[model samples]
Target: MLSTSEMTPETIEQEKLYLDLGLSEAEYVRVKQILQRRPNFTETGIFSVMWSEHCSYKTSKPLLKKFPSTAPHVLQGPGEGAGVVDIGDGMAVVFKIESHNHPSAVEPYQGAATGVGGIIRDVFSIGARPVALMNSLRFGNPGTGNVNHLFQEVVRGIAGYGNCVGIPTVGGEVQFDNSYEDNPLVNAMCVGLIRHEDMQKGIASGVGNTVMYAGAPTGRDGIHGATFASGDLTDDSDKDRPSVQVGDPFMEKLLIEACLEAIQSDALVGMQDMGAAGLTSSASEMASKAGTGMIMNLDLVPKREANMSAYELMLSESQERMLLVVEKGREQEIMDIFAKYGLEAAAVGEVTENTSFRLLQHGTTVADIPVDALAEEAPVYHMPSKEAAYVKAFQQMDERIPEVNDHADMLKQLLQQPTIASKEYVYDQYDSMVQTNTVVTPGSDAAVIRIKGTDKALAITTDCNSRYLHLDPETGGKTVVAEAARNIVCSGAQPLGLTDGLNYGNPTNPEVFWQMEKSVEGMSAAAKMLETPVISGNVSLYNQSNGKSIYPTPVVGMVGLASLEDITPSFFQETDDLVYVIGEAKPEFGGSELQKVVSGKYEGKAPGIDLQVEADRQQQLLRGIQAGLIQSAHDLSEGGLAIALAESVFTGKGLGVEVDLAGDATVALFSETQSRFLVTVRPEHKEDFETTVDNAVHIGLVTNNDTLLVRVNGTTKIEEDVSTLHQLWKGAIPCMLNRKA
Candidate 1:
């Protein structure tokens, strides 16, 4: 190993890796000052990745503070591998969402698979058993660019990892737009169960305790991925295929079980998954979090490749790997647990009293830095931001919107819109019933998974409408959170908390920074009003191509506490059931599906949210669900009342529906209003349900005939066969994809 004293300008000039690693001139100057001189090659590589925007959260941390990350039932918050929340009976739910956008763009299958693999490890690293998985994927329009290939492979990637790991892919979301043509977003969310007492903090503690490496042997895969993720994609992005970490689900399965067993063996101090910056992230973060230091010998690491440099060993983002800090005498005991599962385990380092990070190769110091300075002291910037010009343009375009001629025709068109269409074609490929605990799988308001051996159920949903965010970042941000909470409550669950994945363009661009700022403010206000804290989340910046930013997509993935017995189906079940429309309706057509189908427009600020009214409506619905008065419930979104009714009937078991409204046919049927839902109850229980809720308008009845009929003031406006609506909605995406292929 060469020291900085032995390194000279010739070697640094030849490599000049700083430009390729996304390190700016100022950053390199800072690194030199931190070392009190020029750094050798290995030291330079370590600092560049650790201090990167993807690893350090430099630009987004200031905005993240706007979120409310703590609640009374929260067992763990944002700083750990994942957030944990107590759900009564000494049980807790652990969950988080992470992005693998850049890697997925280069190698869709491997990138997406490792995204699922990494999030699952985050949960089990804290001593939880992963029970359900979900993914919110975004791609270019089906026929445009490489969308079809990206779409098909990304799905296969998620299925390959989740199915093999035996965790059910319960629920998630998928959206298509040209904005994501070059840089598709692959966000994976995993939920796990653990007893509150068994949850482990990912920290390095005890001065003499040994640090062990477990699971797969290290290799030179996905090196500098943290740096790769921080940069925007370009035509040459395909050449970075080596930065995509390959996944091995079988190894991950063994790792999850072995880690859980070891956590309960009373032989561990701390544990964490080696994700992102890999060993560099895990070791530095563990040491930083505990106010301690770690000294590691590169020779002791289990590796598949021979003659690897110290730099490659530290930065390789190898999949299915973990770092464990164990008690002084329990090294072999910990080794025995993983060895039984056929995994490699070795003591590679030990905790120290001093707060320094040191790496030794064959007993010679190769790299040394302050642990906190490496993990936590990256520079934080308050980027300049202002409202973008496009927002005002979208608002002004409203005056040119055209009128709708036929309500029935408009309903049919909106149904065929890809975002609003049925996703069964996609979810059917997933093994959603693998765990046999999935009470309500895909094609529901929220996916509900029953907690085994208990009467409790956990409801989960992830949502974000990029058009809304693009039109009005503040309102769109608030709407995303509100929609997630609405989905949870509609399933008879009280939303406990939420996780977020904030995807945007380069934050150095002031216009993009403005969107991020406004969206966070909206999410913070909504979370406080709904009393659901944001427990865990990931931030994905640099989602742009050729200087064009994608929509400000900050997805809100929410979890709620519910009971299996109280869970309400989103379909109309019985004939003669009375359908009630709750909450007020306004004609706000900013980002509605109707705008796309009928007018080809995206205009106006987002439909504003009245947080108190939204909160009141959720509580009222929950009360009705508990009292056994509400039979079925579904929130009104996208195409509004019209699409909601059509979807209510499109379910194979639904009989039919007839509605009589009170306003202009277009406004009454297609307005993208907030805080509204279509709920049904037996005709006999209608009186009691109406009494319990405010603003409950009886607008429709479930009939025996399989027809979707609508009227305004008893005049026929929309009339169509249920099966006709079903075929069109179900076939749109598959047909488009097939034709494109």
Candidate 2:
């Protein structure tokens, strides 16, 4: 209810400035005590935005610390713009995923566009050339008119920015559900390549260094954007339109080249992207990290609008802007680089020896506050938590997984469901091959991008099932990481590092907070045992609308590494190739797609993770690929055995698969078992494959005919044409989204 208009010119009270700036009373008192006086208008604005939940991670920091952030291959972890891992041969990969939820719900196009722009900046700011981009999108049913419009616009926004910037939108995931009806999530992930020595930190080191600003000019747009992201979307969300920053991909393109070139020139000390809290976060955090201070002049900054005040310039989230700390006497060299790209690089500030950040407007001091106090001293709250009653009931439910009466019809129904159906209609619009490094495109188990010169390659995948999390948060969290790792490892790569996008409902709700705590604990335990340290990630809370919260969705975006010779395709390659099942199938049906399709419910217990078994399977698969034994590999997830088999044959024409299964019908076909894989080997290498891969079973072989058949214990259970099932699987999503057959 406290509005900025309440603070009038003549009647303004210095003590109440934080209230108008959206800070809690306790936080205001803390600010006052830190400065030993009531904060001035400019100082209040800076602290308010920097200390907000979105920029400071006040509530989530303690939970984030539980994740495994440091591994042997990790060069830099959580504190940087994006995590960096040494990927061998003196090259490293930089990547991260962040959310732009509330803004996207209000203004889909600009919100989504800026999200892409901001992440790209994060990558290049660390002195890396962004190679690939991916997004994890969730919405209400796109079949409806209103939601369909939003879905289309968000896709277009992503394409417009990524395509124009020339970063290939390689691979991502999308699902339509009612939980996202009013508050859709648009999470963006970007991966970049850089030499190990060229990797830079976003720190402002050295006293008396020259500080500069470049790219787009400051404007009235996107004022208070960071604070807006810290809160929930309400009925008045549309009125916050001015808080969303507009993006210009062309300008961003120039900035990328200029920054990369300048970094190579070795004239810059540190660089930070002007995202989130805009100038406030980028400047204060950099100086604080470097154990330095700064004095900035608002008048020297390039501004697109006239008569902009100090508060507006300090907090505006203008797109395509960056702050650079350059070495002394090389200012012109840095300026000339950006100027060559037609971007203005103006001297805006200088690093100081004092430990305070001082602001100047027209040679007059406006705000002075301690650098570390503003960036590192936010109030971190340990939220109150209580487990929701519904969670226990859902987990303890006695619902039965229906019998496999008609396996063929059941496969078709599961294929048509929104979650299991093909997403070609959505991926078709993205430019996945622009950079010419995409080895395996969107339809595969995980995306593989070639490292142009070296024999090395990279793999990426994202996975999460909200229903499983809703029923059992801890298990669902562990399963998501396991699933993502399985996809990457199945594609014949060794798990290297991970980046997570944690999406949940309002954190203030005790039930929601409890879910968050449990999920993080689960994810942490799994990461440590697997040794896939979580290098970089993001947390997005307050994902509810109209008093309705979404199911817990903690999306894991993982990256893996391998030599080009180790990459494996996820498809049926040749006739007479021996088919084998790796890892055992259990009677686990909790949170399975079969339950959703047949019983119309999300019930049962989630499958528990056995770290030793999971680790053995990953090593076994990696060894097989290294030994050139695996002809093709794909993990069994979601629809379990049946769905994975169908997908393997979905892309091939005139190719059929025949498999013999002897087990419980439901468990063998659709049990949603974890850490299992379907693999094929050359007939000649069958002996070595079985000898090398433990717990492996020879199932059947690829057939040359058009008919796909499955027999359980010598009895035919599923018999259908490959083309018939392919049509239903591939056309489901297109039909729904385009409203056309």
Top lDDT prediction, candidate number:
1
Candidate 1 colliding pairs: none
Model 2, position 723: C-alpha lDDT score: 91
TM-score of every candidate: 0.97, 0.96
List where candidate 1 sits over 4 angstroms from the true fold: 1-10, 13-16, 395-402
Best by TM-score: 1
- lDDT by residue for model 2 (677-736), tens: 999999999999988889899998998887789999898989999899988988987677
lDDT of each: 0.89, 0.87
Cα RMSD to the true fold for all candidates: 2.0, 2.1
In angstroms, the error of model 2 at 490 is: 1.0
Candidate 2 at residue 516, lDDT?
94
Q: Which stretches of candidate 2 lie over 4 Å from their true place?
A: 1-20, 739-741
Q: Give the TM-score of candidate 2.
A: 0.96
Clashing pairs in 2: none
The sequence of per-residue lDDT tens digits that candidate 1 reaches over residues 1-741 is 445444453466356656656777788778778877676677777888888888889999999999998878999989999999999999999999999899999999999999999999999988899999988989887864378889889998999889999999998999877788888999999999999889998899999899999999999999989988998888899878988999999999999989999999878999999999899999999999999999999999999799888988999999999999999888999999998999888999999999899999977998888888788898888999988998977766543233799888888888888788888777988899998999998988899999999999999999998888988888888889999999999999999999999999999999999999999999899999999899999999998889987888998889999988899989888889999999877878777777766656566767878989999999999999999998899999988888989888876774889888987788888888899999999988988998999999998799978899888887899889998889999998888787744
